[model samples]
Target: MIEKKSITFLYRTYKKHWPLLLLALFGSILESASMAGLAYLIKDVVDDVFVEKSYEKLIVITSVLIGIAVGKQVGFFLKNYLYPVVIYRALREMRAKIYNRILRAKPSVYRKETSGDIISRATTDVERFGEISSTIGTNIITETFTVIGIIGVLLYRDWKMFMIFAFTVPVLAFALQYFGEKRKKYSKRLQESFSQYIQHLNQIVSGIEVVKLFHEKVFFRYFNRINSDLFKRQKKNRFYETVYLSSVEIVAYIATAGIIFYGGIRIIKGEITAGDFFSFLGGVLILVNSLQTLQRGAINLKALTPVVERIKYVLNLPVEDDKGKDFKGLKESIRYKNVTVKIGESVLLKNINLKIKKGEKLGIVGATGSGKSTLVKILPALITEYTGEVLIDNVELRGYSVFSLREKVGMVSQEVFIFNDTLRNNLLIAKPDATDEELIQALKKAKADFVFRLENGLDTVLGEKGSRLSGGERQRISIARIFLKNPDIIIFDEATSALDVETEEYIMEEIGKYFKDKTALIITHRLKLLEITDRIVVMENGKIIEEGTKEELIKKKGVFYRFSVISSS
Candidate 1:
């Protein structure tokens, strides 16, 4: 069943290379025919050249052997040419498709999968698929046809000898049945072990600082455990492969011995000519070698099931739905009607009714895990699987395409993610066609003018996660993106949280002016940030418990008052 599945996958992935396939087919046929010709020529060499002792026949036989050699070489060249072409092209296409799927897939997919596993699937697993192409392409096609041609030659020489050789087929089949399953099982385990190994590596690299600061014993123990498990699985996999090879060798030697004994008896009795015996020997050698190759290929194809299944899992993930009415701009207001967000048994956002008019500056302040960020996330339709409706201009958020809605709404969060690329490229992600002058102006507005001091200016390449920039500088770059986009609605989720007091005050004062005309929602734990907003909502335990003007809330001495008092102190 796995063999059939592997074959089906190969056919589907590579069917477009039909022209190359045709050439490969033609070449394989020629190769097979040439192989048979070589066997037949052995008979002529013995009978006509040696026994007859004729110089004329000897020259003719020599010429014919040379011709067969040339044909076989030509066939070998053409037949093998397409294997790499099909393998590389098919894998390139597969990688491109998988990468596209990764980009378009919903955020939830990322939550359930590890970064290491995803990377391994895209790189290592795709490579395994490429191996399947080579294994099935060259081994199955050429070897099978060559075996068939040799069998024809053997039957022509002597049917009795051919029958003796054919008996080994069932024995080889039994060997494959038992050994193939074991190889498949071990191969799957090996791949999973590799994933875990990669995940451990990723965790250590991403958190290298934390690992360095903390006691080193815990990390070393964890790594040792993972490495040991990987080594054990790898050892088991190699053991099974050795077992498969050993079984194949035993079967091959026994088959060869039986054929030799039978053929020798017939030759001694003068039942068959020396020429006939030699030709049959040639044919049987080809057949046995082909059988060994076929066995190896079958084992490899079986092992590929785990890789194909892993790739299929990622490709089958539900991509984000982009088919909906186009969104132009926010006209009047955004409304949240009893919206609730849940994941498994945990509720992140409770039923809430709220509205923000066009050009309104709304502030949300709450302790951690109070759903402040979750509440704003719903307005942009990032968290789509909610209980009730989030409407913009009275149109349901789901009614608008994700791309168009996100295009009109921009968000800058506390955790700024900068690409390991140039400052210009990072800024261009917000507005691809923005000119240098426009970029500078936006950078100025966001108080990110530090770019001008760099030797390369906008061309300066940032390190991973913008490690080249300070925390305040990275936050400023993120703010620059928001300013460049100039979306109809802007949401800042503690964009100034990590900055020192001076930098935070500067960023807040600068970015505040940019939000004046746009409908904005700001989430911050710092109560001082709310002074710039017209209205503020205080949340606790996924529900909005207090809402009013900042002054009004302070006068009420409620949750907002308590938050303000705690933050100031």
Candidate 2:
């Protein structure tokens, strides 16, 4: 039995296509009833033309058969035509919904799942779901009616023949149910195996340079292993399909042969006419065809159950708590009181208390894994699963809308992600309504005039992840975006670490001027970048060990002194 929830969800999803659904249903009725009508007309063609020698009635019977043929053709056309519209439309809506849900999901949800798995669910799984949904929708209605009409004709013609065929129903039902569970089991496994294969493929393609340079044979060995597993899994799934279909065929043929033998004996005993025997056999054939179709439909729908569950899991995940009121720019202070962040059994940040006044330029220096990036990430509510209090202007961090909170915060990280789009469009992400002149001015502020040399200037398309641009050029474009955004708080998480010394120096000089009045938090390995900041905080082992003015920290000769000495060396 299909769950009520699944039925409700499917109905709501395609409610707008109900008119097409109705037309398809009407078509199926006409198509199935025509076959039933033909079986009834066979008695006339057999009895009247052969026994009575009635030539006049022959013209009427042929005309009626022609009309039934046309009706069936119209029905076939309607069912086929409406099905694709529903399939593609549902696919488009589902893809859009999944993407939107992914955006609204918390960062931790992404950490738990691989990008390739997510992509497969959105593309491959969604396509399969679409096909199953269309098949279930069309075949369920069409085959049900086809079976009913054919069975009704059989019972009306002769009860004995109907009883003989009905005896096979329980046996076929058990067979279909057993194989359907098997198909469902293998279908889920096949989908999971494909996700793993896609993940490996994505990894190899993205890191092809590394594989070619150092580990070609090792990578190929891994690739071949996954490929072989996929082949075996696919073959196993196909084997079950073949067995299920062949079993249905064998059972149906046995039932048909038994009905013919029994009915022919009755006709010879003079208990029924030749027309009656032939008409009963025709209905039996239609019933077998309808039964096969229904079995296939059932198996397909059962196999898709796991996919529907996967989709439901994603769609039902808790979206970020974005319900709070709008947040204007920061006015007073951002404070963290005894905040701690934990991931599984490991604690990333422990009882880290700190505060940054509005317009304060704070510099943070720490070794890798010291939680420097995680600290600043909390300000924008990007990493929300933490203990203790984070307040913005005396309000709890969760009190402000996440989207509104992010609007006030701008971040430029070491690894800048550039989409495969025009530079103009990339810049537009920060300020969509920015004019070309405004964009150029922001670019100038970030020392990113290199874009002007591109083939189409601002309109030039960057390669995937900005692959065509040099590292410095990509960094500059990212900085230009931040300048255009001009948020109240700016965060630089080793933003210039990827650039050469010359590029870093020039970019930092421009950034120094840009940070004049805005609240800035700079996390850098190069201690020299801390010169423009008002205060510096040194973190080690997820705790702020020392914090003071740069001169004061250098004078203390504590952790800051050792960091400075290492930087100079």
Q: Worst 10-residue stretch by lDDT in candidate 2? A: 309-318
RMSD of each: 2.9, 2.8
Tens digits of per-residue lDDT, candidate 1, 290-381, equal: 87788778777766878888888877777998889899988899999998988768898899889899999999988899998889987677
Q: Give model 1's clash tally.
A: 0
lDDT of 2 by residue, 1-569 (tens): 67777777778778898888788778888888888988877878888877777888888889999999999888877877777677788778888888888888888887678886777687767887888887875787788888888888888889887898899877877777687677767777887789889889898889888878895778789889888888888999898878877877787778878887898888889888888888888887777777767877877777476777777777765778779978898899999999999977878898988999999989999889999998999988878879999988999988999999899899998888899999999999999999999999989887787888888999999989899988878888899999899899999999888777777887788877776788999999887788878899989888899999999999999999998999989
Q: Alpha carbon lDDT of residue 361, candidate 2?
A: 88
Best of the candidates, lDDT: 1
Clashing residue pair totals per candidate (backbone < 3 A): 0, 0
Q: Which RMSD does model 2 reach against the true structure?
A: 2.8
TM-score of 2: 0.90
Clashes of 2: 0
How good is model 1 by TM-score? 0.90
Write down the lDDT of every candidate, Cα atoms only.
0.86, 0.85
